[model samples]
Target: MKEINREVEAILRDMIEQRVRAMISGEATSNDLLGILLETNIRESQEGGIKNAMTTEDVIDECKLFYIAGHETTTVSLTWALILLSMHPEWQERAREEVLNLFGASKPDYDGLSQLKIVTMIMHEVMRLYPPVNFTERSAAAEVKLGEVTYPPGVHFLLPHIFLHRNPETWGPNANEFNPERFAQGVAKASVHGAFLPFSGGPRVCIGQNFAMLEAKLCLARILQHFRFELSPAYAHAPYTLVTMQPQFGAQIIIRRC
Candidate 1:
């Protein structure tokens, strides 16, 4: 396990370095986020004070973080989405119909994907039921008080998102049930008690949320366009956590061409 971890870390480090090298060699186009980050770092280093300027190591660290966090969260969420859609064939058919109606036989574009209300609703429901990250930890820089609880400096707080998401007080009696209609009026109307936090919430929310959503929508749309799927007979329902909540065994689904 340790050897595997080291190999993973080494691969990640190489990827970060490759991007940095690409940016330096005038090979990477200044269009994507990586290019933008590289440009910003260079501009800041040239124009700002030492405190404001970011070192090469800082850029690599940020890139590695963005790559891993963005990739992991989205992959887990999409996997769960597929599993849920397979279990609920009716919702899956409805989503496919919606996608077909919007972009039939054509590539799903940004504007069209944004207009997919039903698909968005299903995605929200899946996220609520199976959030990628089970919990989040935040350390207090200084002493802080919230209501009756007082926290000292260097205190680490564990905010369990799954607990809040599944709470009956927050989501009514059908909190644990798969009901996309809860988000019918939109996310704002879904939870009035600040309960719906699939992306963590507030300023500390996942930074690549928009990117992840777009990625999921496009992948799901493409999947729906060409295939119909359902859980396999051998499939087991076991969700466990490592860095993220994932299928402990595996998510086995049978797919057929639509």
Candidate 2:
């Protein structure tokens, strides 16, 4: 792990250096996240002195977090959503019909995307079933108690959200089943409080949660507008977690133009 992290840091350091040089030379202006971050850093340095700005190491760390949390998590989520949609054609059809009703072959716009109730429900259900991150850990800020247990400050707790998501007691009899209708009312009323946490919960929840959902909805709508898809004969059902939950074997899907 140390070796892999060192290698990744080296690559990120090189990228950061190149971007810094570009900014210094005025060769190009970037509008991407990295660019915005660099711009902010420069502004801070100019206004509040160098100590107020993030160091290159800080930028590299932020980039690493965003790359993994933003990219990997969403990619795996889309894959799972597609795989689940293939398995449940009825739901897929419903989602497609909803998308068509709103956009009607036009590119999905911001307002239209918000009106995609079925697609949103489908994405929520997919996350519930195969959440990108299987578990998240948190350290107690101060001494805290839950039920009969008490923990000291800095006590780390591993919350296995996968198990919680599928709890029959919390989600009812069909908890393990694919039922997006459960979320029709909305996430708050979907299940008990803290029951459906694909992106985790609380103030420290995944920062990209909203953006990721929006991206997923838009991507799914576009795909539905263009194609009908299903699981291939060779597809296997084996979800495992490396960093995020993904199919142990690749997801093989058969897609045809709409």
Worst 10 residues of 1 by lDDT: 55-64
Cα lDDT over the full model 1: 0.86
Who wins the lDDT comparison? 2
Q: Considering only N, C-alpha and C atoms within 3 Å, which residue pairs clash in candidate 1?
A: none
Model 2 worst lDDT run, 10 consecutive residues: 22-31
lDDT of each candidate versus the true structure = 0.86, 0.92
Compute each candidate's TM-score over C-alphas. 0.90, 0.93
Residue-by-residue lDDT tens digits, candidate 1, 1-258: 899767766775676567767767878555877678767776676787677777666766676688678998898888998999999899999999999999998999999999988889988888888888888899999999979999999999998888988999889999999988899999889977777777887788888888788899899999999999999989898988888889888899999999
Candidate 2 Cα misplacement greater than 4 A, ranges: 1-4, 141-143
**CA-RMSD of model 1:** 2.3
TM accuracy, model 2: 0.93
